[model samples]
Target: MQALLQEAASRLHAIEDRLTVRTQIAAAVAAMSIALVSTLAAGAAIISYRHTAALIESSVAGIASSTSARLDRFMATRRQEMKLFTELEPMQRLWQGDPTELRSALEALQRNFDFTWIGFADLNGNVVASTGGLLQGKSVAARPWFKQGLENVVVGDVHEALLLASLLTQRANNEPYRFVDIALPVRDTSGKVIGVLGGHLDWTWASNLIADVQANDGNTDTRLSILSKGGMVLVGPKRETIRYGGDELADMLKVRDGTFRETVDGQQMLTAFHVGNGYRDYQGLNWIVTAS
Candidate 1:
């Protein structure tokens, strides 16, 4: 009986060992399954992170490119405008005295500047003199531009060269010419209107100026012109002759002002208005000059 009891005890011990070993194996398998799932989850998170980072980089690059393009354009335009104004400053200074000096300066201007015509008009709106073509000393007193000056106290009339192109027929060739005119008012120290200082400019100079204004970036063509106080069109291309006193410029007449941009007929024009101080120490009969 003792032997039989010992044998039973050994059998029970073997059975208990086998159960322990199976439990340990099951625990190891469960742990390995959990580790594999966690690894896959980590890899998916990394891929998502990479995708988000790429999108952010692309957005930033696009914005930077757009900003750079706009900035480049603005700087280019400002530079060209500045250069043109500088060229006119010396002529303005010489206009304050000696009608002869003004005439001589105009002669020099015609020779040195890029225009098919350069001339002057007296306070009565008559063409006193001109250089560079047959229009010199020709009477333009009857022209609408002249009439507009007579009515307005102190503002410039800007317009296209075409209005005055009738005077620029070639001597031997049937070639047509173009120009830009800036009809400035001549003033004395007493701030009185004396006469008008006119600039007959070559279209090339202005066109070159517009080209140089890098901000334009070939987006649109630009034209420059001055309007009378009543909003009459003084300068531009493809302009039709309109009656003076009844125009928009006459109705919107205002004080002397300078520098603005507007759109006309699908084109952009940047302009400057040199408003006159009527007849105070003025060097001419038309308008006074005061750094406008």
Candidate 2:
């Protein structure tokens, strides 16, 4: 009995230590599980954010592309129509010395196509026949369209109409007349270049197209802009002159279609851009379309 008691006492040291070790191991396992779950949650959140941003960027890019395509098609169709109209025998009869018939044809064209003005200019830049006869006998020698038309088919960018502004019907709010020029050299029966057919499209047509795009896009948060090759804002929601700097333009030209975060007029925004690629047989003006 004495030997047994001594053996039992030797083996009976601190049984609670095993319990403590077990508790520590259990706590460590719980901590590891929690930490793993936390890491996974953080990673998921990051991925979700990136995905959402990508989708938003893609949406805006689509808008910009669609708008650019529509504008290109419209311009292409008009230019193609003009190219065909010029080859018609009725138009070729203009040089037959009947100014009234020529003027009548110009008026019919303006009426059909919603042009602000249409005129025929001789090689010497004399306005021989016009839509309303307003610029008749006037010399358009200094006009860019007339000069460019002498060489090749031309479609000019938007600009304030200098000589035709006051002569045109004024808006109630007194906005100046703006125009986009379409001009091409006319050829005689023997394929000799005779004169130029110059037409001024109402800039309102472009503005209306923009309005329609905005309305159809169904995104109130999206802002759209039409920018010239020079980066000047040709049409936009705001009246301020918004122009992209050289650095921005260079980056945009590199991609031609993409999105970037930017600050415009003190507001932070994400902007998507698409460059214009003109339709068949028409050279694009390199206009940039933007949606933010």
Best by TM-score: 2
Q: Please give the lDDT score for candidate 2.
A: 0.86
Looking at model 2, the pairs that clash are: none
Q: What is the TM-score of each candidate against the true structure?
A: 0.36, 0.87
* Candidate no. 1 TM-score: 0.36
Candidate 1, residue 137: lDDT: 57
Q: Given candidate 2, what's the lDDT at residue 75?
A: 86
lDDT of each: 0.46, 0.86
lDDT, model 2, position 283:
79
Q: Locate the minimum summed-lDDT window of 10 residues in model 1.
A: 283-292
Q: Write the per-residue lDDT of candidate 1 for residues 104-212, one digit (tens) a residue.
A: 6667655654545545677766555556434555666665545554444222233444545565555366534444344545555555666665554453443344234
lDDT score at residue 264, model 2, on the 0-100 scale: 81
Once fitted onto the true fold, the runs of candidate 2 whose alpha carbons sit more than 4 angstroms away are 1-22, 237-242
Clashes of 1: 50
